[model samples]
Target chain A: MRARFWIVASLGLAAAALLGVALGPVGLSPAAVWAALAGHGDTTTVTIVQAIRLPRVALAALVGAALGMSGAAMQGTLRNGLAEPYLLGVSGGAAVGAVAAIAFHWNTVVGVPLAAFAGAAGAAALVLTIARIAGGRADVRLLLMAGVVVGAFANAAIMVAYATAPPESVRGALWWMMGSVDGAEWQRVTWLAAYVVIGGGALIVWARDLDALALGDDGAAALGVDVERASRRAYLAAALLAASTVAAAGLVGFVGLVVPHMVRAAGLRQYRTLLCGAAIVGAALVISADVVARTVRPPAELPLGAVTALLGVPFFLFQLRRLAARS
Target chain B: MTAAIEFRDARVRYAGAGGLAVAGVTFAAQSGNITAVTGPNGSGKSTLVKALLRRVPLAGGDIAIGGVTLGQMSLRDAARRAAVVPQREEPAFPMTVREYIALGRFPYASVWSTSDPGGDRAVTAAVERAGVGGFLERHTDELSGGEWQRVRIARALAQGGRLLVLDEPTTFLDVGHEMAVFELLAELARDGMGVLLITHQLNLVARFAQHVVLLHAGTIAAQGPPNAVMTGGILERVYDWPLVVARDPAVGAPMLIPLRAPSPVTVHRPMET
Candidate 1:
């Protein structure tokens, strides 16, 4: 069952990547896209596929993979089905950093992501602290409440930053915040890949700890897990993934929140399989969403984040209802 | 032999609470014996188990598992010596029964180690012993209450510890299933494993437990053989309720039958229309 899930997910991801590269403003055939990928096509086709679409698709996949795995780790460690970096205020905090960098004109490739990382780490710490203070870390309602409050604060901070920025920067930041991968570069893709690989690898290694954590703090401790340390490590890794995705793309919503549920619904419950499945499926979802975002309107492109949110919000509501009924 | 687990004047105090939850309680659970701790609500029965599991730190005094003081042992070391079945647990995410039972091997499974033949053998044995082999592939959420309880016991058994600790293990179980659990614990104890049980089932404790400790107001009100601890005088006083001790017809062990508060006899007056 696990092997079959992997095969299907991989095929879906490949198909989505191909579609992302082939269908765009210029609209190249799959054949042309294939030739361009091999560096044997016409210059225009080569430049369009290799220089523009290839990097964009790669960025989308990496960002999706990062968010997907991070979401799984967060959900597992927190033992809350609704726990995701986006919903937990980690992404919002990263956006705060990215927006601040843009407002101050410190838009260096490395500087923005680093600032975003710091902000994400800080936000994760703050949310945990708030949850701890409210009662216990095991209180799912308290944790979500803390996340929502922190997220609201981050949005307000972004608005204040926008108020002081130049019109051009504000316009660009608005599009970015809504989320797009329009000008994807190899440098950005490489950096995001590094973050995803390292952070996602750490999550996979700590998957057992995550499995134990699902049994509750006392339960995990009785099973020989250092609950506090394991949770902290998971939070850091998840924060890194969330921050890097925000730095790469803008505020792409719900990929993190939705992907793990999709994987679990497919019957992969263990953390290792669940995390890996989420990464593959997330890549496919985002790549497909990006394709639709670019193609939906001929001359104008939809925000990638907006497209995902459209699909994700309904799924989130459905999940909420299911949980309520169960409890 | 030294006790498999010992709590010497152990005390546990929750932060912001006015008093110690487990106040200077001392006891030893020996191998090949079932030691039962029973008490009313708020009498610190569960608190002692928590301290033994290292979930709560000892405010004063010491707890030792397998002759090693808790302060000197890592969580893994402690787990290697003792396994616990908590009073209640619901998996946050449902997995197959096989996967759930395999979690018991976590203490022995190294992070980098992918496979463990020994752990697998232990898990298989546990499944057989707990009689949960029939539904190994079913998800935990699909299990009935009895099945879930047995599955938890299987997980604890698979941990391969010499000392088994359970907190209210029979809660929510039907009469037959509850008796089965008690019998299983007794069987394990007879096989030279130390079993520490904290429960409200006084009658079952009397029948199966070799040593009984009755707590009241965070102190040991009585401790001795079941026959000594199960007397109506001690039980009624500790429980603060009216009850009688009767001999079990089958096992001859003491059985407690709690009585409702006595009501005054009054002549029935018909209600006027």
Candidate 2:
């Protein structure tokens, strides 16, 4: 029965991806999509499908998958259902790192994602360090508060940088801040794919350890898990996945929070299954949301982050109420 | 001649807003013996088990297992020698009973180890022993409290350790399930496993456990066999209530009875006429 559910879900996500790739204002028919995929379309058609739409779709999948898997690992380790990539300060730290790079115009000298990567790693370290200093391993509440403080600090820093930059750079930062896949090149997708594959693969390997963790730290330790070591490794992996995705796509909030819960609610419980299922569903959700953002106003676009919250807010509210009722 | 576990001057201090919960506690468990720690609610019974397992770091002293200091052994190695079944646990995610039980194999198997028939046999045996063989496929969150407690005990059993430490293992259980758990532990002890059971159910402890340690006010009030330690004086002092301790006529075990306070009478006339 579990296998059958996964098959159905996988098919649904594949169909969503194909549909997202095919549907746009210019409307490539299924035949055109087939031809473009088969590498026999005209130059203009090929550019629209390949250069413009394909990279965007692929980035959506990569970032979405990274967010979902990391979210699962985070929630499992913390033993808190409300845990997410952003709530842990990975996103905020990465954003701080990226904004600092943009403000310094590091992209002109170093590269786009490299600066973003550095910033994200720095932010992750900062959050972990602060969390450790404040409350030890049991200081989960303190860590969450630190995340909020760090996120606010990063956003303020981004605004200050935007205010001081050249007018051209200001528009660039604003666009990036709005989170469009409009100019997603093959480069961002490639790097993100590599990171997710490595990081996601590690999470799957540690799936059983994750199961032990759900039993609370003491219970898990009693079961023979090196509670501290497992937690640290899982946290590091989750941070890497979230940080890389943030570096690629600007802060696409709540995909991490939403996708894992949705998959679990659908009865996917095993870590291997949950991570795989959440990855596909997360990709499908982002790609479809991006399509809506682009088509809602026809050539004009909405921010991808805004679109994510539209899908995320209602589900989050439902979850909160459900949890409240359960407890 | 070898002890399965030994706590020499082991102390656990919870640095709450107030102060410590346990001062200095020392104990030992020999192979093939059922040793229990019994005390009032605030007497640091749980703290003793946590200190032995290194779940909470010791505030002062050292704990050794098989003559090796707990600090010298890795957490995984300590787990191999000792496994703990907590009184209660809440898992964040819903997992199947079998998957939850299989987590006991965490210390035994490596990440890349193959799932062989031998592994399956051990897990099956543990499930049968813990008496949850019928509910392996059910969701853990859906089980009744007693059933959940049994499942956790089963998981600890499956860990295949020589020393088993349990904290109030019978908290949510009724007469039947509680006896069932104690019976299982007693049987395991007969197989040469050292059992350190922390329970508030003094009756069961008096009936089954081979040795007893009574704690009061973060210190050891008394320690010995049930016949020696379940005295009325210790019970009343530790519990802060009037109580009676006598041997049960039917089972030849100790029994406890609390004496309720008398109500104040407004009209004070001597009954003696």
Candidate 3:
């Protein structure tokens, strides 16, 4: 099974990398794509592939993987099937931070990514603090409630920013708000890649803690697990991974929520395997969605968020109906 | 042998409550014996159990397991020495009976490590011993009340602790299941695991428990063998009602018959100076 996972992951990375280079406005054929990747193609094709589309593709894959792993970690820690980074208020918080940074024109010193990271961290802190104050004792139900309240407040703040921002800033802010990988740069992709590797690695290593949590607090505690410590570590890792994704790719909705559920529904429950599988599937899902978003309009670009929502609504509706039918 | 559990001047005070729930209670549950804590409602029987497990904070005094103070021992080590099945605390996860029983092995597991295979074998054996082997594959939440309680017993058995503390283990069980659980407890005591249970079932406690400790208004009202403690005088005083206690011929256990519902006094005398 481990070998199979590695084989599949390698295949996915290869396919994504290949497709990333081969599919663009200036389409490089597979042979040319390989040649350009190997530093043997024409200057124009090489520059467009290397400088423009490759970075976006890399950014999408990295951010998608981060979101996927974090979603798995979040769900596992809470022992809830529906938990995700968005459910923890990280994405919404990051969105608020990014939007605030853009609206306030704080792009000169450290840029929107750092601002977005700070925002996500702040949101996570607030949700955790409130849940603790409520004395829910880190119970899954209370964490979810905190997420809902925090997400709502963050959305309200975002609306206020959108509602009151100057007309010129709104267009740019809206683009970020809508979630786009269009203008991704190598520097941003590198930052996101490092964050995902570190944060996702931590989750994979803490997989056993998730298994312990599945047994509830006493069971976990009885097994020699410091339940509080395990949960806190998982929460911090999930928050950081999520914040980095939003920092890199803006507020890409549903990728985190959708991927983990899809993996669990497929009968994979182990955290390490679940995280790995979600990462692959999430990256593929987002990349495919991006492909559709880009191709749906020849000259104009549609908001990636719109495309994801358009696709996600049907998937979500289907899941909801199935759940209702089961009940 | 040092008792598996000792409550020395133990007191449990709940938040926002002035008095101790189990005040100045001292008792030792000896190894290879079943000590039953029984009392009327709101008499702090459960409080004493919690204090022993360190689940509730003690307002005063000390609780020691195997002569090691619970306060000094790490919570994990304390768990290793004792396993508690709280009154009617339901399993919320959708894990299978085997999985639920396997949770008894958690204290030995590391956060980043896989479960020990030895613990897994012990859990399976414990389930089989508890007579829930047939229901091993079923989801825990799907089990009937009797079956669920038995499963909880299996988990406690698998915990491999010196003392098994149960709080109202038969709360929702029918008569047959209740008897079945008590029989199982008797077997556990024979196997040298000290068993302490908090219960409201006086007749069952009289029949099965080797020792009985009665609580009234957060203090130990009486403690002794069942034959000594299940007297009519103590019953009437504890319950604030007239009651009769007599031995049943078939089971040779003491049984109770309440003679009157608290009939209020008809006339009041002047207060004594």
Candidate 4:
């Protein structure tokens, strides 16, 4: 049964990558996609597939997998079905980092993700500190509210930076603020892929800690999980994932929120299955959403983030209703 | 031989809080016996359990497990020796009973260990022991409260620890389920595991627990066998009410019957929120 699910998810991602590659301004047939991918097509077709479509498709998959895995980790640690990377203020923090880098002329490929990761770390620290002050993991509500406050504060700082920047840089910051994958290059994808593997792979390895967490902090401790240490690392990993995706593309929302629930609805309870399923389904969702974003109107692109939310909200709502009925 | 778990003047005070939650609590849970901690609402019965597990820090004093101080041991070492069953089980995501039970083997698992037959064997044994074989594949949310409690106990059992600590395990159970749970705890105790139960069910304590500790306002009011501690003098003064203590009709367990309060029991104080 598990193997079947894995095959289905992997096939879905592969099919979605092909579809995303084929549906852009210049539509290509399946044979053409394969021919171009295999370097057997005309020069224009080869460059289009190899240089343009391939990087965009790869970045979409990587971002989806990273965000999706981070979402599962967040939900598992906070023990809330609605917990997602962006909702926890990580994307906002990354935006602060990236925007600050761009505004200050420090927008090197390496410098941007580093700054975004630093911002994400700062947000996580603030959230954990607030939770501790409210008396040690007091309630999920406290953490969620703290996230909103921190996100708002980060957004304000980003705006201040944007206001002080030159007019040309303002358009660039706006594009970074509203997420897109138009600028994905091979070099950036390689670096982002490393972050995704390091963060997502570690979370998958710590699946037992997530299992222990089902019983609560005290219960988890009694189950022999190093709850404090494991939870801190999980939080950092989740932040890194969210930040990396933001650095690679922009703030692609709803993949984190939508993918995990999709995995859960398919009846996956374990973290390993959840992470793998989320990665595949998340990749499919983002690629499909991006396809719609670029192709909805010829030569005009919609923001990829808006398209994902539009594509994902109904599924999220249906799952929520089912959850409410069950409870 | 040393007791299964011993407390040496254990204390717990919430940081920056006005009062200590647990103060100078000293006791031991001997193996092969069920120990009960009973107290009023404001008392620190829960705090005592948390202190023993080191979930809450000891503001002062030390706790020893089998003659060794708890401080020197690692988290995994302590878990191998002791397991706890909480009052409620609220999993944010869905989990099958078998899957939940398998989590007990987490302490025994490492990164390189995959597809553990040993974990499966332990889970099977625990489920059978807890009499949850019928619901092994059922979702946790689908089970009744009693069934859920049993599954949780099975998970704790599967952890393979010598000491079992239960923090008000029967809070949400019905009368029959409550009695059944206590009976289960007694059976586990008889099997040579040290059982520490914190509860307000005095009648159940008298019936099942071998030893009882009465707590009042974060301090130990009394500790002895149930028969000695469940008398009218200690309970009435502790609860500030008139009460009659009588032997059970079938068994010799002590049961409390309230006569009339000198004044109506005060309502819970309102909070600022």
Candidate 5:
């Protein structure tokens, strides 16, 4: 049964990847997509399919999976359904890092991601501090409030930076803040892939610890997981993954917040399965969402972050409503 | 032979607390014995158990499982020596009873390795021993308090450890289930596993526990065999109320009952110097 779930999920992700590569501004047929993938196409066909859409799709899938898997790890450790990267101040923090790089005209390869990592680490610390003050480690309501306050502060700081930036820098910062996959290139994809592998790998490795943590911190300790060490490792890894997503493709919101919950509700209960399942489902979700963003309007590309939240918020509310009815 | 757990003048103080939660308590629980910790609502029985389990820090002195100090032992190492059945704390995820029981095998299995055959055997034996076969596939949240309590015990048993410690394991149980759990603990003790339980149910402790430690205000008020420690005077002294005590008719176990209503009177038993 578990194998079947994985196989189906992986297949869906593959299909979405193919669809993403095929559907863009240049109306490429399936044969054209295959021909481009096979390294045989007109320069125009190859340029659009290989140079533009291919890198975009890869980045989307990688970032989506990172966010989804990180979200699953966060939810499992915190034992709260609402514990997502965006809601935990992770994305807001990463955005600050990326925007700072953009606003200062630092166009180095790794500069923005390192800045994003620092911002994410800082935001995570503040959120944890707030959670601790509210009570013990991470009560759900206090965590949400902390995330919101941090996010609002980050947005305000970003506006202040924008207010003082050059016109070109402001455009770049605004575009990055709103989040887009249009700027994805091979170099960015390679850098983000390394980040995802290291960070996402940590998330997958702590699967059992995450499960034990669902029982509570002290309970996990009694179960033989070094609760403090394990939680720190998990949280930092999640922050790393979330930051990588922003570094690669700005701030793609709602994918992390919604995918893990959807996977759990679909009957994958264990963290091992949930982590892997959420990754595939998340990959598919963003790949398709990116496809819609690029093609829905002719020359004007829709913001990828807006597109995901547009699809995500209604589903999130429906699930919340169902939960309310159940209780 | 399996060794005993020894507490050498152990004390635990939560930060910002006015006094210690469990203070300078020296005691030992040997293998093949049942040790009961009993006290009033605020008497620190729970605190002592938490301290021993290494869930809380010991501000003074030391605890040793077998021969190694608790502080020196890793979390996994400690779990291999002592398995704990904590109070009924619900998991956030809706884990089924079988999956819940499988968590007991966590210490025995690697994170990368799934479907551990030895772990599966332990889980199966624990489920059978704890008698949770009926609700094996049901979600833990769907089970009654007693059913969940039994499953929690089974999970600890699946830890494959010798020392079994429980914190008010029978609080939500009915009379029959409570007795059944005690019998189970007694059976484990007879099989040469050490058993330590913190309980408020005095009558059951008298019948089942071989050694009883009466705690009050972070101190051991009394510690000995039930007959030696469970006197009416001692009960009145600790509980601050008049009480009657007698031996049971069927057995020589101590039987205690309140003899009169309090005039809202209280006892302030002086702390030992």
Candidate 6:
């Protein structure tokens, strides 16, 4: 059963990546797309596929994988289904850093993600502090509320930072904040891949600790897990992944929130399998969503973050209702 | 041989609380024996257990498992020495009984260790012993209360420690299952594992436990064999209730039955209408 799920998910991701490469404003046939990928096609077709669509699709997949695995890690460590990077203010925090960097014209690949990581870490710390102050970390509602407050604060900070920026820089930051992979370059894709691989690998390595954590703090402690240490490590890794994605593709909201659930709904329970599955499925979902975003409006492009949120909010509400009923 | 678990004037105080939750209590649970701790609400039964598991830090004194002080051992080492069935827990996500049971091997397995035949054998033995093999494929959330309780016990058993600690293990069980659990504990004790049980069921403790510790207001009121600690006078004083201690016909263990409080208002007999 597990192997079958992996096979199907891999196939879905491949199909989604194909569609993402093939279905742009200047449509290309599958045969052309294939030939372009192999460096044997007409120059325009090759440039469009290799230079334009390939990097975008790859970046989308990387961002999606990062967000998806990060979300799974967050949800497992916090033991709350609603705990997503965007919802937990981690993305908002990263946005604050990335936006500041852009406003200041410090657009280097490493510099932006680094600043974003700092911001994401800060936001995570703030949210946890707020949750602790309100009651305890065990209270999911309090954590969510803390995230909302931090996210609102991040937005205000972003606006304040934008006040003194050049009009062109502000325009770029604004579009970036709305989330678009429109200018996907090979450099950005390679950098983001390193972040996702390192951060997501750490999450997978700590998957057993996450499994114990799902049993609650005391339960995990009894199972020999250093609960506080393990949870903190997971939170940092998740924050890093979220920050990297925000740096690459702006705040693509709910791939993290939605992909883990899709994986779980397919009966994948263990964290190792769940995290991997979420990565594959998340890549497919985001790539597919990006395809729709560009195709739906033709010449005018829709924001990738907006498209994901449109699909994610309803699912979020449905999950909330189920949680309410259970409790 | 050293005691399986020993507490030397252990003390625990919650932050911001007025008094110590577990106030300098001392006891020892020996291998091949079942030691039961019984107390009323807020008398520190669960707190003592928590202190033993290091879930709560000790304010003063010491706890030693197999002669190694808690300060000297990591959580992993402690877990290998003693397995615990906590008072209450619910999995955050859905997992099958088999998957849940595998969690017991956490202390034994390392980060990169994927599969362990020994761990598998332990899990299978636990499933059989706890009688939870009937629904290995069932989700934990779908289990009945009794089944969940038993499943938790099975997980502890799979942990493969020399000592087992349980707090209120039979809370939701029916009478038969409750008896069966006590019997299982007895059987484990006979097999040379030390068992520490915290419960409100004095009668079952009388029948099963080789030693009993009675607590009152975070302090030990009495500690001895069942006949010595289960006496009418001691139980009545500690419990602060009218009760009688009688002999069990089946096993000759002391049985406690609390008496009703005297009526404050005299009831007039109903007229035959």
- Which residue window of length 10 is worst by lDDT in model 4 chain B? B264-273
Taking candidate 3, what TM-score does its chain B reach relative to the real chain B? 0.93
Query: Global CA lDDT of candidate 3, please?
Result: 0.77
Q: Model 5 misses residue B163 by how many Å?
A: 0.6
Best by lDDT: 6
Error of 5 at A79 (Å): 1.2
- Model 3 chain B scores worst on lDDT over the 10 consecutive residues at B264-273
Give one digit per residue, the lDDT tens place, for model 2 in B161-255: 88888998888678888888889889989999899999888988898888899998678899999999998988988887678998888898988
**Candidate 6 lDDT tens digits, B1-273:** 899999899999988999998898999999999999998778899998788777789999899999989999999989888998888788999899999999999998888774466999999999998899999999999998878888998999999998999999998789988988898889989999999999999999999999999998889999999999999998888877779999999999999998876674653433421
Q: lDDT per prediction?
A: 0.87, 0.79, 0.77, 0.83, 0.83, 0.90
Which candidate has the top score in DockQ? 6
Segments of candidate 5 deviating more than 4 angstroms: A170-174, A318-327, B1-3, B115-117, B246-252, B258-273
- The candidate 1 chain B region of ten consecutive residues with least summed lDDT is B264-273
lDDT of 3 by residue, B157-232 (tens): 8878878988898987899999999999999899899999889898888988889999888788889999899999
For model 1, the chain A TM-score is 0.95
Measured with C-alpha atoms, the lDDT of residue B202 in candidate 5 is 85
User: B170-251 in candidate 1: lDDT tens per residue?
Assistant: 8888999998889988889999999999999998998899899899888899999999999999998987778999999998
lDDT (tens digit, per residue) of candidate 3 on A1-327: 445655665686668667766776666788987787777868988887788878878888877788888877876666655567676788889888877887888853356666767887788888778888888634656777898798878778877888899877743555555678888788888878888888889888888777667766555554445677888898788887887777666667767768877766564555767788888877876776666667677567777767776766676567556545534
Q: What is the TM-score of each predicted model, taking all chains together?
A: 0.94, 0.89, 0.82, 0.94, 0.93, 0.94
Please state the CAPRI-style docking class of candidate 4: medium
Runs off by more than 4 Å, candidate 1: A104-106, A129-139, A167-173, B263-273
Write down the worst ten-residue block by lDDT for model 2 chain B: B264-273
Candidate 1, lDDT over the whole model = 0.87
A90-137, model 1: which lDDT tens digit per residue? Answer: 988998988777677888877788888888988888898999999976
Which of the two, 3 or 4, has more TM-score? 4
**lDDT score at residue A65, model 3, on the 0-100 scale:** 85
